[model samples]
Target chain A: MEIYRYSMYPLGLKKLIVPCRQLQAFLQDLLESTDHLKAVLVTDKDGVILAKATGPDLPDHVLEPAFSATFSVASDQSGKLGFGRNKMIMSTFDEDQVVQFNYSPLILTLLASSKANSGVLIAAGKDLEEPIKIVGESVSKAIQHEHKAKEYV
Target chain B: MLKPKVITQVLQQANTAGVHAALLLNPDGSLVSFAGGTEKDAKVLAAVASNVWFGYERYGKPPAANSVEGGEGKEGLRNLILDCEQGKLSITRTSRMLLCLVADERVEWGLLKAKTRTLKEYLEGPLNLVASY
Candidate 1:
């Protein structure tokens, strides 16, 4: 089974692959160290999935839109309810299941089981704050590069 | 204590900072006060409130049903604050009214939040008091 699943992108987004790969590596390490069973990086604002890491139980396509919709809801709630700009959202469906997002241009989302350490997972998600910021900036740069390249072509 | 003054202040702060638009809506989502840098139709405010209410009905309630397990108080309230760049809209809630701030791509959310925080505190206190009388 494919552990990672993604859709084809136009050449404009092809430039983002390098940074996306780096983000995938960082997320893989983060997920492996913690008990986070699934991880996805989505483009902030747009809700496009850039990369993901999941176990065999979950498929990439299934998780991609799930992350996008969750982020969309969170972002929507933040806008309508007055939570300020949504910097992060951590929600527990039950004692065993939790979903989290750190909002940069790239959002780091995690799914963890009940046995996982909630506090640790929260902190680990927060820990990715800087890296996520870096990833967003790099992706923005890549997009710019792609745009410029297109202009030349 | 004057409603117009408060509305002016909210709009001015939002405008000076280059925000797109800011307005105050009643709990039911009627436009009680408004200040927009650009002209907007009165119908837009009503539509926004209706949209928020629709969202509240959809995703805002079910989570509360499970609130007895420590899930209720603010989850619904939090859901009311929704953002949609696709829609070019942002809204915040207070005890008495929903504050809707609309902007295009140029708005900086950080600054908008700070301004809204100030406004929220002000509205909750003196503004609420005025509304009561």
Candidate 2:
């Protein structure tokens, strides 16, 4: 029977390949100037994390649920609440968090301190749009390539 | 003529009841008919169809079984209707056309259900007739 479980990218994709490293560096640079950015993760519409940036000590398992919940909340709010395509979702408590879904499939989620500058965060997000789109498209291609490789084996 | 008339009727019904918006989309997530008052972007229809496809694949039963049951009954592959505070979406089985209605959360559920019932009947007759021919 077929099982449904989250699978990681193949070893070829995992190797410090040019595209993968560039994506990581691009994300790290994108978040560097933003203050109190606790974490940033990019995931597909199906809740698969394509890439993530977090503190060194952060565990791996937390990424999946965080991305899934954020996507669900954003999609639900857009559908139910009149959020107008759900460009951005901000949740402010002891800390500030922002989740943005662009181009229908790619999601960029960020966690920051309450004192973080909302304007800066929004600006940085806007600037990252092109890079994010490139990364998302590349990741999608990589996934497709991996699938084809598996089928041939 | 048939498509536009259907659009007009659905919009009129939704407007009389103070709904937000309504739309009709083809199986490939393209707009075939639209009504009501709201943004008329094609993206909205695509988004709604994407969600509907996801819901059907995840929670819905098999397509053939759903058709058999819906056809035997009056449902006619009516699939699922999602209710949101801003709007609701209903997909028809025959051509995979979607009827999306946006309304205030305050709108009465019973009233909406009644309207959908009327729509289902109207669509079922014409759709089944076309299928047989």
Candidate 3:
């Protein structure tokens, strides 16, 4: 029975869950720390929103697909620029600022007020290193599980 | 209306400010003028700048909410900075064209921003002239 359970858990039972709650919680904490921040979004390369946290003034749907489009397009073109992989992109507008990070297999976008200190926001993004690592590992494991399961069937 | 002399002046100022290379490009990423960098890198920068600007315009800006008074989304894009492993790429929008700069690790972010502001001001007239042409 123990061996059977081990075979069933080939993908590692510990890492199977996507850790959606942890990501949401981290984003929520990040949002609360700064009023200047409007929203935080985590998405895959395909523009699928995996986790998000928004301020009271901003609605969840406010982001739509525009944020994803911005990051995806920039990242794709960035590679051709021969600067190696892009680390971060910061764009400032009239009233808002958008910062996108190339987390590989995942893209992290932060929407903030134009008035916010960009240095602080960039530091906040750097703080996500640990969480991003965990999330990346879990997501990779989930994908591996799906593939392995398909092979079994 | 635009003169090669004006582009040279701006590029010279940028080089003095510690930028390794710079390129002046149209919104579509066509090279208007280039200084310091290899031709291949300049072309790539122009293409990337255009794509990034297009993406920001089309998707990055959200629609203004009906209830959100005084909120507008039609404002012109100010600039874009991409921090990469190789170095930093800063693209600023002038009245008509894009100014792209590639700086090495020796350049500080604050210093770069300050220089970029001045470069943008210097390039505005010439870039606008290019647009008019």
Candidate 4:
């Protein structure tokens, strides 16, 4: 429900600035496009909430950033064993609530009911990968821009 | 000591379904049993997994640690799955124990994950693993 805004560099590759407005619009489209997703939270490597969209029955407390941060550590380690970098983490909690996470230039936390189709949830996460990259880069740019402005003042 | 044969059977069963390796660990990360990997590999898996379980239990809050007294099963973490470029890993837990499965990239994960409860039962029953870690 609460969305955090940040400017992260995309995969730490190309440096580009994506406007915060664009990020919000992308989140909106993702929500409308996916019927099964109950909520989505975007966070940085530190597990700080950047931007999020929530549906019914979701509150801030349930969308903890600390849990999301651990995935990043797992992701980094996975790449070391000659395996590719980690793409996502899926956890099924009690009563069939399923949570899926994707780590990268951005970390995505998704929640859905136990009855929701697993395929649909996975596809939805894949669909948002690009948009999240751009949004993440936008956050980095925002922070950098703020720092620059401070220097001039 | 837990029966090695039953633990081996469970690991082999998991391997049949494509979980290349599996292990049981105490909350502190000591190796209880392992299936499908070299001894060195098993040690690596145990070391990393116990740390993960410990961190999650100690710091992952609101839902808090599942081991916390009176915490509902649904309140905290139940299972965790990760898909990396090369392979996949899944970790499930009890109050005092952890089950980690390390599988190859081609594994049929959904089927394997669906059977985690049965594996946990194997640990608790014939394997005689203590649940109070």
Please state every model's RMSD to the true fold in angstroms: 10.6, 15.0, 4.0, 6.4
Candidate 1 is graded, for docking, as incorrect
Worst 10 residues of 4 chain B by lDDT: B60-69
Q: In model 3 chain A, which range of ten residues has the least summed lDDT?
A: A1-10
Per-residue CA lDDT of candidate 1, range B1-133, in tens? 4667756676667655456567777766567677764335534654555564445444433232223343343233321223333323445665566666655444554555566666676666656666663
Across B1-133, the per-residue lDDT of candidate 2 in tens digits comes to 2567865676566655556555555556676566655444535654655564444333222122123322321112233343443454443343335555544545654465556556656665665554353
C-alpha TM-score for every candidate: 0.46, 0.43, 0.87, 0.76
Q: What is the lDDT for A48 in model 3?
A: 81
| TM-score, second chain, candidate 1 | 0.68
Q: Write the per-residue lDDT of candidate 2 for residues A50-138, one digit (tens) a residue.
A: 67677554444434344444445435545633424445433333223443445445777665555676556667766767877776666
Backbone clash count for every predicted candidate, in the order shown: 20, 2, 1, 11
Q: Which structure is stronger by TM-score: 2 or 4?
A: 4
Q: Show the lowest summed lDDT stretch of 10 residues, model 4 chain A.
A: A1-10
- lDDT (Cα atoms) of all candidates against the true structure: 0.55, 0.53, 0.77, 0.65
Tens-digit lDDT string for candidate 4 (A1-153): 011124243222223333445655676676667765666677777777667777655555556537667666766665554456677767665534445456456788776655677667777778877778777666666567656655655
What is model 4's interface RMSD?
Answer: 4.2
Task: Sort the predicted structures by DockQ, highest score first.
Answer: 3, 4, 1, 2
Model 1, range A1-153, lDDT digits (tens) per residue? 121134355444666667678877877787777764554454565556676666655534334234445555545555543324554443333333334454656666666654576557667777777767766776777677657756664
DockQ computed for model 4 against the true two-chain complex using alpha carbons? 0.45
lDDT of 3 by residue, A1-153 (tens): 343356655454356344867888999999999768988888877778878898887755567646776687787778667767788888888778888888877888888888888888888888886787678777787777667766766
Worst 10 residues of 1 chain B by lDDT: B73-82
By lDDT, rank the candidates, best first. 3, 4, 1, 2
